[model samples]
Target: MDFEEKPFLRECKDIIEGSFGAYLNLSQQIGDLVNQHAQMVREAVSKLYSLLILTGNHSKPDTGIFMQLLKPLSESIMAIQEFREKNRASSWFNHLSAISESIGALGWVTVSPTPAPFVKEMTDAATFYTNKVLVAYKEKDKTHIDWAKAWLQFLNDLQKYIRVHHTTGLTWNSRGTPATASAGAPSAGGPPPPPPPPPADLFADPMKSGPGGDDTRSALLKELNRGTEITKGLKKITADQQTHKNPALRSSGPAPYKAPSSTSQPVVKSVAPPKPPRFELEGKKWMIEYQSGKRDLTVSDTDMSQSVNIYKCKDCLVVIKGKVNSITVDSCTKLSLVFDDIVSVVEFVNCQNIQAQSMGAVPTVNIEKTDVVEVYLNAKSLTAEIVTAKSSSVNVSVPSANGDFVEHPIPEQFKSIFNGSVFKTEPADKAA
Candidate 1:
């Protein structure tokens, strides 16, 4: 019985070893395929950059050359996809995806008829994707990392070439002076050849041109119309291509990646997580709230000018400067708002213990469901609408009809909750 058990255990050991060996072989094959794919992508990017230079120099790209280069690129992209599908759970999936995207962007640029203007854009996009791949693998995969870096350098060189030699109008072949001119001047007695017939135009006005007479004006008009139509068609094509450029922008599921337009800036989408109410302002943080004790927020003119949106904040002293388009504060408690040189529309709702001052333009102020509101504005015009405030105090200085400053107190009826003096008006000159 002991001998029989020993034989069975040997057989089981052999089976397990064989299975492990097979898995190792498969992994080796996959690794080889990945390297091959990366090599193909590198080659494609190189060829594409060469072709772009040719195009920028006014030389037409050869279709045969493009087809030859594209074949390997397409193969690599496909192989990457198949591998990713087969090993969906592998940690390398993200890196592989990023590599594929970079290659796809290069491929798109390669086939584009007018890619010179987009060279920088495509190169930047490729760099972005390749960096993502490097980050995913970290210190692993040194070969591919080096390859990607080299490719990026090549792209940078190509971008510089395109920018320096870009041509604006239609490219014309150099017409060496006619052989006759080099040989000798035309014979004085020989009649000059008749001017070439005007080019045909589908929209030409026949009645406008008389026989045996030059119709230069009519021809110019026809050319202008044709140029306009061509421009419109080109614009439509550009718009359509932009729609497919960024996969992140598409409402549908992820698709093959393409480079963003070189002429346009990239759009960033932000999704911020909800935060607990607090008043803290430091550096670039938006939400301001007091955590333990009193705090001060001194916003410079440059900071105010750059802020596009201001949200809820409380329990701190806020000094605003410069101009903001609009500002909205809601549900804040024990807040002090000071305006140094603000030019903005401001709204406050359900806020308590508020103080506001305006030294520049008196922005349109809208208040609702607030208590203990105070404002001091030295402005040309003061416009404010308050829905409800328990206690409100206001001092405004406005220029009189004679350009002199005058102070006026806000009407008692303006404060609905309870108010002794809601507004105080002073002469603008005296306030200054």
Candidate 2:
């Protein structure tokens, strides 16, 4: 019998060849964009970051004041982006000296502390001023999450420093908390503040058990179990398994206890680390799966990659250095993706917290059933159509004048009204 190509294989081959032929120039442009910009801006950003830390970092243990000192840090990132634009050809990543300065400034601070009341105020202020601080890194646009984390870290450092090194006998309080009175202060003497309340027994019963049975019936153990005793149920099954075929590794002991009435007592499986990611080129599609914690996954070849399928990855940074037919990201979380462009469409489905950047032109981008996705479109991809449905916190950042990224949220809200006889729905006009 003569061999016949299956419809699926034939369709894949046609899409690959057709996309390559149609968008070859776009592929080269994206490849150039990646190679040119990815390694150029690091040196400048590092120098700027170090200078901000050295000049703005103060030893004072006041969070509000320290956050106020971030003004210079905010201005310097904008300058770095401008410098990157001008010196794109000459700059390279360098060993920055200012890292040592940052370490020494917060050396006394060790543990994280509860945020002061002004934390919410400062956070709101930071959100208001996000336009000034967000700078474009090679393919990754710095999101508010990155900026907020830095602010929260400095706040924590200041809190810890106050706790550790502040002199005794003087109370340092947050914005709204009451300060302790210094020694020998005259009291307002009103019935001695109604006498201090007595401390409760730590192991008291909720239902008022007798004193003899209190220890055994106390709710303390149950309360602790409800919160912190998560590991008790995560015990792995110890029976000999079909997957582990080696007899030497098999356990000689009896099988571990499993609870009966499984309808009520459901077993919680122990977590095992996922296998390292694999990229297989099947026909014309690149299948990327099980990826996690990977920082620099590069697909540099322009000709070989026709399309991509990224599935079930977490906390991964994948950069495709060339244009392709299409890319589909499915069932992934916390993915940082950077690609040049696509011939057809770049689609995201059932994703969460995904941040993607397109350095070159794209025809269309689709996001469906996603949560908290940030898309950065460069000067080239400004005209790309971003079609979104059933998604939220979807923000798109495009370049504006003055070398800053202006972020705008994709409108998920709509206004429906009865226009005479029929009801019509359109995207909400926030301006109206």
List TM-score per model, in order. Answer: 0.26, 0.38
Against the true structure, candidate 2 reaches a TM-score of 0.38
| lDDT tens per residue, model 1, 1-432 | 322133322332233234322323333444754454454444443333333322222333233332332343345445555655564233343345444544444444342344455655556546544554454335766655654555555455544433433323212123322121012212122212222222322222344443322456657777788965757655344654465685555766557688887888778789785566443332333334322234666656455433312345656667666665344455777777766443445656667767666666644665555666766555433554332333344434456678675754444352233256675543333323
Candidate 2 lDDT tens digits, 1-432: 101132322332243234322223222233443223322222222222232222222122333232323323333333334444453222121111111112222211212343233333333333322212221122354332343234334434433433433323112323322211111111122101111112322222346544334455456676676874655687576555543665655476457577677469667899997677787766667778888888777777754247777888999998987878677788999999999867767878789999999988887788878999999999989999888867889999999887689888888899899989999998794522
In candidate 2, where is summed lDDT lowest over 10 consecutive residues? 91-100
Itemize residue pairs with steric clashes in candidate 2.
none
Residue 239's lDDT within candidate 2 is: 57
The runs of at least 3 residues in candidate 1 whose Cα sits more than 4 Å from the true structure, single-residue gaps closed, are 1-285, 289-292, 301-314, 341-343, 380-432
Q: Number of the top candidate by TM-score?
A: 2
What C-alpha lDDT do the candidate models reach, one value each?
A: 0.45, 0.51
